[model samples]
Target: MDSYAIKYIGLLCLLLAFVSCKKKNQNSLPETMKKDFVTINYAKGFSIEKPASGITIIKVYSPWPDADEAFTYALVPKALQTQPQLNEKEFDAIINVPVERIIATSTTHIPALENLGVIDKLVGFPETRYISSEATR
Candidate 1:
């Protein structure tokens, strides 16, 4: 192979390694709690951590290249879910899991919801014209 082809292959290998090695939260969890955390499949820019205390933490990384902020969500147990607590301020958004209904704002989100087989969870869209998917209608 030419020098340019060899260089391109080397560059591609480095790029793949960088993306694959992206850091994940390293917070320690109890052995018992680790088994209860739901495994998120085929997802990017998010991580879930559940402590034995019963509250679940979800960290969502901003997809935008220019955005430096990431959002945190705390899912409190049913009994204490309604009561506001001091730590609630740390989360960007928090609510009970199995969110009943949501207004899907973009078409790009449709595929992810569809892939999760939860397209029925969407109750509305900002603009109907952009939704070309018949399944979403």
Candidate 2:
């Protein structure tokens, strides 16, 4: 091969190497972008009280409408006997409840609840006409 041909081959090889490197970097993402959890310190405004063994009560504002009282619950780690079938692996970690009773407050939640075969548990609803389908009604 001549000097020009050798030079052209070297240039082509360098271009291919750069293209492959760029493609590899595009496939990989940073750890911060992949993280799903967000930590928040909300203990500043709330008053913590110890009731008994394995019971800690905290007074906090309600996240729902028409709630006059501060929400209180027994913060305990309960074990699950049976596992539910979830679409994604992350959903298994997040959802711990059996979801026996579901209150459809809006039209958007009605159709999905009906499809999941748990429509009978929907004892309370906002408005029928807004979410009532032909079959659901």
Candidate 3:
């Protein structure tokens, strides 16, 4: 092959190797309270950890069906005015306690929120027409 062809092949091979290596760096969660996180097993889909008082870490495994990875959310008290001392990579999002507003996506969640006495916090729901609860309607 000519010099140009040989160089092109070398660069292509290097790019392919880099892409393969990057894919291997991704991580996933089992939600069974793996070795790294504290064993506050919430369920097969999530794990709860309390690294500090009034601060909760909820690691949701497989956010979507058969998802390859997981997401972690930090629920901190609004009064704290600060986040917990955890790794920057530990959580994907941070939410405040006493959730002021809610947008319940599932009908199943509505009953539970109502029973918890926090149905008033629901500001938005897609399927309000399907609800039979007079209080929620």
Candidate 4:
């Protein structure tokens, strides 16, 4: 072979080696490890502890009427009485008392009480048809 042909073949081999090496390095990362990477925002001077896989966050209204009713109904179960920060333009925290017995007068109140697991604490009702099954009747 001519010197020029040999030099051209050598250059082609070098280029192919570099391209294959680049591809191998890119694929060296495990797919699961790459997929699990997440971005988190932290407030100034705050750091987060790594969360467990099944941990969940739910946004709850702070100091809701149900919270008050729960408070009045049974002195506020420790799990439900957390005072969350309120949005100044929309809602405000009015009361922090423990609830025991709820007297539901409006249609909306019964459903709210039932969802909080305090349906049995509903001792009195004004309008009855809205409630299912005349059990309370």
Best lDDT goes to which candidate? 1
Give candidate 2's error at residue 73 in angstroms: 12
- After aligning candidate 1 to the native by TM-score, how far in Å is the CA of 25 from where it should be? 28
Model 1's lDDT to the true fold? 0.80
Q: What tens-digit string does per-residue lDDT give for candidate 1 at 1-137?
A: 99999999999999999999999987977554563556889877888887766678888887577679988888777766666652657888777765778788889999989999999999999898898888886
lDDT of 3 by residue, 12-115 (tens): 99999998888465475554334445665455878877653557788889888989889989877877646445456777987878789999888888899989
Give candidate 2's error at residue 68 in angstroms: 23
| Candidate 1 residue spans exceeding 4 A from truth | 1-46, 61-63, 77-86
Residue 99 displacement (Å), model 3 = 0.9
Q: Best TM-score goes to which candidate?
A: 3
Q: How would the candidate models be sorted by TM-score, starting from the highest? A: 3, 1, 2, 4
Superposition error at 129 for model 1 (Å): 2.1
TM-score for candidate 2: 0.30
RMSD of each: 19.2, 17.2, 14.1, 14.6
Candidate 1: pairs in clash: none
* Model 4 clashing-pair count: 8
Q: Model-by-model lDDT, in order?
A: 0.80, 0.55, 0.78, 0.48
Winner by TM-score between candidate 3 and candidate 2: 3
Better of 3 and 4 by lDDT: 3
Tens digits of lDDT, candidate 4, 1-137 = 99999999999999999888884445554542332323356522212221232222222333354453211111123343564432333322223234566787876676666677778888787768677745444
